[model samples]
Target: MKITKSIAITLGLAGILAFKQDKEVPVKAALQAAQVHLANMAAANTDVTQYPRSTKKDGSIATTSSRDWTSGFYPGSLWYIYDYTKDKQWETLARQWTAGLEQEQFNRATHDLGFMLFCSFGNGYRLTKDPKYKDIIIQGSKSLISRYNAKVGSIRSWDHHTDKWQFPVIIDNMMNLEMLFWATKATGDSVYYNIAKTHALTTLKNHFRKDNSSYHVVDYDTITGQPRLKQTHQGYADESAWARGQAWGLYGYTVAYRETKDKRFLAQAQKIADFFINHKSLPTDKIPYWDFNAPDIPNAPRDASAAAIAASGMLELSQYTGRSGEAYKKIATQILRSLASSAYLAKANTNNNFVLLHSTGHLPGNSEIDVPLNYADYYFIEGLIRFERLNKGLAIVSTGGFLTVN
Candidate 1:
């Protein structure tokens, strides 16, 4: 009997991974467990062909399809695990998941293409040099820039009309700028880079408070291109600082500085980091509440995703800021340690196989109120990989991790 190409690939993936367990034993174990959990979840939900957005209370998953912003994270997680372990099976799974997301290349409705395309195919191209992935990313970047409003100097985050906001730009839009910068590098197109820079500068001017904590939404006047309202859509209050928004600001500007080598972005990133690290509301474990100013104080639900992203951003930020880099690295290390502990990291075959638990997605709106999210695990794995590289103290990071000046 002759096996088809698809059959052969399936057989190849059927073989268990031969994890080269080394100093990064905890992370290796986590990724291995994730593979098993993901495989089991897919088997249990035979109707679902791909990973969903997140798991709910009863062990059911959100059926949000590939068009959802979070659709990239599951594939991105597979890619990061592949990069960490060099396991062929991870690569195969990564390719499979990423392929399902290919249709999102032209999704122009949202400003999350960076989260959707770049995290999946961006990492895929980085590791494999797949020209196909490169093509998709360039096209996706173009689609992302289409949402940019030259008059507003920012990318419009939502298409829906609001009574108060004609053009709403959320802080989360900051995460999408990396794809534009990548497009500039991949295709030598300055248009993409310029739009990202303008968006970032405009966001910097309006989204942050004097102390650097960020608002969740900065609705701009479509005609004047100036910020109209400072409000919170997902936070505790309209005036309160949401934890994840601050995390996005920290990570976003870190990448901005890395791409442009602009000192202002670096300064902005550090200030956001300082706001987080010094805030009295941050937990002793470094995990932040769903809202920094949540009325409940210590009893507020913690967002592991925010901690994960902030720690990962701090790892890269550490390498940039000379002496202060060490302090940032220390805070990042503490956050990573807390996240890796039993309280957050899921046990083997638990939490519906989600990697990290207790990420509060949208508390005020009552969505994903303390469940595991795909993005949380994605950033945790990414943070661990960066931590391992940081420990190596070698220049391997400059290749796969962050940008550094000579």
Candidate 2:
């Protein structure tokens, strides 16, 4: 936690060497480029009801309604820019986008309020200490916990996959538990914390294989409270390791460890991190293919979003990994450096103004393959900020959330 001056200098030199872009600082330059892209996106996406999700095949900005799981990321990205620049203009833009999701606080149908509300209003309240945002987060947490089945021991992930699953839970649900932790912290309620802990424990018990790679979906028997099916909804096959799913598991367990300080969670996070970092299929650049088991191998599409998420997660996990922390941070630096390169980072005023490119969303469903995604940009900016803070001997993240640095 207290980075020594010598260690800080070493980290800074390591980051610079990782990029090797002459005198250009990778984090600063990427953030400057991100600001331009975000400003352009804000101008182009004028409708508050719709959020930027990804780009269409025709190279246009594809959008989603506030109910979509990804709706919070764009606003969250705005908040990150504000956090970095401390500019009121970015704050205003962030607030306007965040305000649109206020009504989602009561929507009980989906388990993504953490992604939809916490990422937006949660960041807003953290930065500004706004009581209104705090209230929205509390209400949203209640809505999210409403989906928690006592018998199943996890929040239901999707309502539409009923025919294929009885009580379905996805590994991505791990990301939602942070808001539950926030709820407990905000309201002094043990109920939210208990539910979050139970869900995380249940996931830890059933979601992971022996090797630490996770199944995307675990369909549980509602009556027996046991998994009936372990399969993939988006990956290559039932037994294959999905790239983004692995990232979610890695990131999610790291968060669990942070909130509860449970050594089990910590160990689980490290195992997942090791599985990902040491995977045989991972490219030299640290950007993973869409699926580690994808039949195409080197011909498979690279998922920049997965790389971004894992890098951000590993940066946080690195702080807690003791002697392995440096190794974790080294791989994370490689990922961030790759993402900031010309191959992944989009040109100014191009790629529909999205900051990064080559993200794969729902490959089995044949959707949003190899496109620029908002969440990729969100986490890329977050990783840059975390790395910069780490090198400067500062706190890598605020206690309020995992994305921002103090």
Candidate 3:
């Protein structure tokens, strides 16, 4: 529960004192800075079909098609900016960027439709109440559920690497469930809700360790409905705890608790949060190395994307705990402040026009090491928005009455 020690050293004596005095999160300045960076990114990346994913080794922006799993994030970040600024310009740009991914509503081949569709269209619909966006979201949910196996009680994650895994389900799939929950909320059908709930329960049963940290991938046998392999495809080793995988578990379970009001999910989320926050490897600034168990400790590349996602998720998790959640909020605030600092935040027209820097995408593959990533920016903005909402006594992201649509 103590965040002041390391955070004090990272942010200097003023920040340590601010933590003691219960100071504001400085969301306005962060948001204002983000707007300028977003504008630079928007101007630089005009091709909607190719969303900015990350920077290449040669210092150029790497772009991916809408078919890429990360395609939704750029548009989703735009929607968040629009929500924060309420400017017609950002809305126009959000719509433009979002429209390119409409074809992905039927992409059932991958288990990432929720990330691909929901993050973009869901936020757009939430902000604008656009009927077209709503329809796309419902269809996208249907597509996402198509990957669900009744026997396995979980959605399949990767279609590739079949030689390695029979039915691979990665921890990142937890992120896509938020859209399914939203779908059932939008419509009165329980099919989406049931699939999502079952998936969460199945993952809850199979994913965590005794210490509450999660494996990156759990390969299930198709016939017996048992885990064939519980290993790490992205971490340092099969037994290593990947930093982003842990973030995904924390965010995923938090959403599960939010959608279902299930206390088990809440308890699981708390345990995961405790594991992440209290882990010995977490740095003084609260940003974690790409893998907690990486052999190169203290020298491993940092994943700002993981830190941003955890910050955003913990902000929401903080809201559910009342006064007991203050510590979670404070830790999340420490992460946000570190991210907003000059060390992480990219200057305008720099970092290939991306907002944040130093995210590790896939270390084992030797790809995207210490580069700017779109999702890091997305979640950093999201964390700022959530903090500002809490400051103003508003519900974070407006669930539209939780279970009821009207």
Candidate 4:
């Protein structure tokens, strides 16, 4: 029973190896690690939160206070897990987290129920064929529809204390239209499709800069559906490209193209992807910084989350464009490899629970600026799983199944 230092180390290493072998490795192992991180986050803050935002001086998270309605990634995190694992535990957690958003959904002021509900319950229903989740998703989509202004032909972005701004449309809002499109398909309602199409068309007309990189925010005339100003709200300035916003535009456009087969959407997606891939701002590793114009090149932080999202979008794009997507496929694989090599935390280490690291949330405000983001972990694992599925030549599941690139 005498334990020497070398013997102790050998036994400990063996135990760890045994544990890892007992469980699944690769994507499943990474998913479990992400869940452990989420659990730790939930235990630390009585809130079973999805994505953690930066805190104010008053110790309050900014996203929690503002009704600006751009919170998308968190609940979507749970939905991603539920779909990947098909675990009832994840489904239960998704439901529980969604329950917290009931008041927000009923407010009739927020425009991102698609981000909040569709990514959570809308996805849940699609995967599990659960009627209750579908009901909630329908209600949430209707709430989002009520924010649409017929005069402006765009959904209102924020209804907070700003009475001066009306029909503010951010490029990021384009992603939310997916829920509306889903509502039209699920319920056979043409109104939802019309509204979604209107928003996409309006964004297409106003959001893109001459460089094909997009503006972060656009102000639309509430009365005549005219473009007032193209500004950058969360980016470096009114013109600089925010890396995450670009990923959103790329991913959103690809999804829109998938839904409508609108040649225009595919073209926009290609343009954005081209802009992103050819940008000088992209790091050698293929991961991008929070702002493409962030000064201090060597010291600039990498947003692994943005890379993960972009990788998934690029893979989707590869499937859309037959032979033209080869470059995107290569870039997507490079980004995923970089993430796995640098940011991914192995499951053997119990001290660090998060699967992916070095994700920048909001560097300007110094909020979760360079930390392991939950959504980063979620999307990294998702990209891996999807890549594996694609390599296996698996069919892309239409109903809550693994979405793969050809």
Candidate 5:
């Protein structure tokens, strides 16, 4: 058999198994494989490093490199470890990663604090019931809310550069609205819920294409509070569908539906999922291109992050709809198996740490295009946990058409 890079990588770290005549393979083995991969990744990030803010086109600090909220995924990655294992060592690492994030809490500007802190500290508090984690999440939520624009009725994004966009709203910002939802539930504050609902409505109306796939960014008229143009900044072109953006739409709408129980959100989630699953451009392993229409596929590398995020959404969908028949569970299992066996990096005691591999950051500068990504690791772990929980016969209650809870 001709072994491709993906197949070779899968065969290398974990041995392949032959199926017996009539018995189905156990899901626990796959979960154990994911756990092994997670353990290896956790061991890899022992060394401490600080990220410095990089320079922008305007000769000012662009995005902060050192513990900025925008650099949220790595710390979020640690939180996954803490959640799955309940290991003190993982907890310790999560604390160390979050200690560095304390500096950004005071900035109170960017919309990514939810991605940075909520996935880490907010999850930490929710899982452990630690007051400190609650405080951290509250502060991060406050910071996220400060970026909301009363004029546009949505959160502002991209403070650094861009002339046509003053209160630009990006599809990625949809993931951050969870902080507002959480605030409303935690503090009994309706304002946060109203704001979050408004943002979701705005995103539903503007950010999505006809096929339910989405643009990376949407320019909104700050004065008139109308959508000016739908565009893509971090994709192949302004009109193209970025794979991660699609993943965001899938996961975000599922989450929104979970929160609101809105059928519209559920419909949107299914639409995005259909677009992703039916795309012929997807790799043989069912992982996706960085951009669906990138114009250089076959040779264009796949984004494992996109696959991981989509897998998480699929598992949630299976639980939401209560139809874990062959087709639904089979695809979910296939994705989990591929990620566990193929993309996972299992080196120990190094700083080049990540779980899911072959993640494409971007293609514009040909930098970090098809490498290990932190968000991929986070979502992959979440998917595994969801699978494990479901396989154990845990009943999932659909919170809205978007989210699932035990």
Candidate 6:
């Protein structure tokens, strides 16, 4: 080897690896796996632009139409893939999948218009500067905020499932506030921004227990603007922590802190992280059971979805604090490493083209249990992209993406 460029480059790579962190994951492999998985999903669905929300037990893709809350995630994930790998095939898939949800920009009945359009069309607009996607996102934000009740101080989460809940506000609704915040910034109007802050403040007042663990749902009385019940629909009990609900709180508050620079939201996020990481039930691997209160301890189903969301949110949260932020980054790195392991990640061409396996969704309701959810895949990709952006000194919610907690 007489100083050939190939030999010099190999030595240079070795020198670079000398300072590499042990927890630094090769998420590029995950990206390649995603490309293969998405291609398979496209072929399996056959011209349908809607996303695959879950995989059936028989290994078939269960596609969700644009009306479903999870319909945006598949396209959003594809956009992240394109952003990460610079692969144009992912761009094409992103656009095609996103087109299916165009009708959702005007759907005012559901609060998930943010999840439907912001995660898909918002990302599309940010990455491509497409005016059409921007228009859709603004319209979708108006539709999402239309569900907000000033008296209740929160957005109404459901309309069809009102038999048990009136003026329902679930922890999951925290995730939809980002679209409102982005809309205010894009339009130079504060009405959407004000509604987001009010909803977050109301949730902060009522949703958290003393220990900082959050309830899954908070049902408000429509007339008096009072909380009639503080119970759960999908958690193990009225007081138990639903894993993904806590994650949604964490991600939501982190986003709010970034947008408003509020110390309360930052403190709320730190406390929620303490509750999650220091909990007795959290597994050594950092992945959590579907419910912290589940009867089965070691035998409970793990929610990789929750772990993914927390990892992405924590990455953004780390930017807000100084020394404490380093700890958050370290734990988040460990989570990424854990999620990239064989235990959580699906093998190539397996798991019906889903990225991760063994996620529990609404186990208490006996639905979507032990399945791969579209949102899980979306956040997993986000964790990877956010990590890359952090190293490059870029923003976590690249182009008005939001995160929150507690």
Please report the candidate that would top lDDT against the real structure.
2
Off by over 4 Å in 2: 1-25, 398-406
TM-score of each model, paired residue for residue:
0.90, 0.93, 0.92, 0.83, 0.83, 0.91
* 1-406: candidate 6 lDDT, tens digit per residue: 0123343244335423432533357565555555556666665566556568997767677887789999888888878877776767668778888898999999998888878888889888877888999888998888888899999999999886668788889888888988898899899999999999999999999999999989878899989999988987889999899998888999889887877778898899888887888889999988999988888988999999999999988888888877888888887888877887778877655787788887888887787888888888889888978887777676665535433322
On a 0 to 1 TM-score scale, where does candidate 3 land against the true structure?
0.92
Model 6: how far residue 235 lies from native, Å: 0.8
lDDT of each: 0.81, 0.88, 0.85, 0.69, 0.67, 0.81
Q: Candidate 4 residues 170-277, lDDT tens each? A: 777877888787888789988888988888888888899899888887887767788877777776777888888888899889878877788899999999999888
Query: What's model 4's lDDT at 359?
Result: 74
lDDT tens readout by residue for model 2, 276-295:
99999999999999999999
Candidate 5 lDDT over 1-406, as tens digits, reads 1213353345224522321221243234444344444444434334334422222334332233534644656556556656655767667766666666765665676788777777766766666678877776777777777877777888887786667676688888888877778878877878777888788888998888887789888877878988887788889998898999998888788777777888888878778877888787876677788899989787777887888888887777665555533344566667767776634443322214344557777677665665666677677777767777777776431211123452
Q: Flag regions of model 4 displaced more than 4 Å.
A: 1-29, 39-75, 161-164, 344-354, 397-406
RMSD of 2: 6.5
Candidate 6 has a TM-score of 0.91
**Cα-based RMSD of candidate 1:** 4.5
- Residue 77, candidate 2: Cα error in Å is 0.2
Residues 203-277 of candidate 3 have per-residue lDDT tens digits of: 999999999999999999999999989998889988888999999999899889988989899899889999999
- Candidate 3 wrong stretches, greater than 4 Å: 1-24, 398-406
- Model 1, residue 406: C-alpha shift (Å): 5.7
Better of 2 and 5 by TM-score: 2
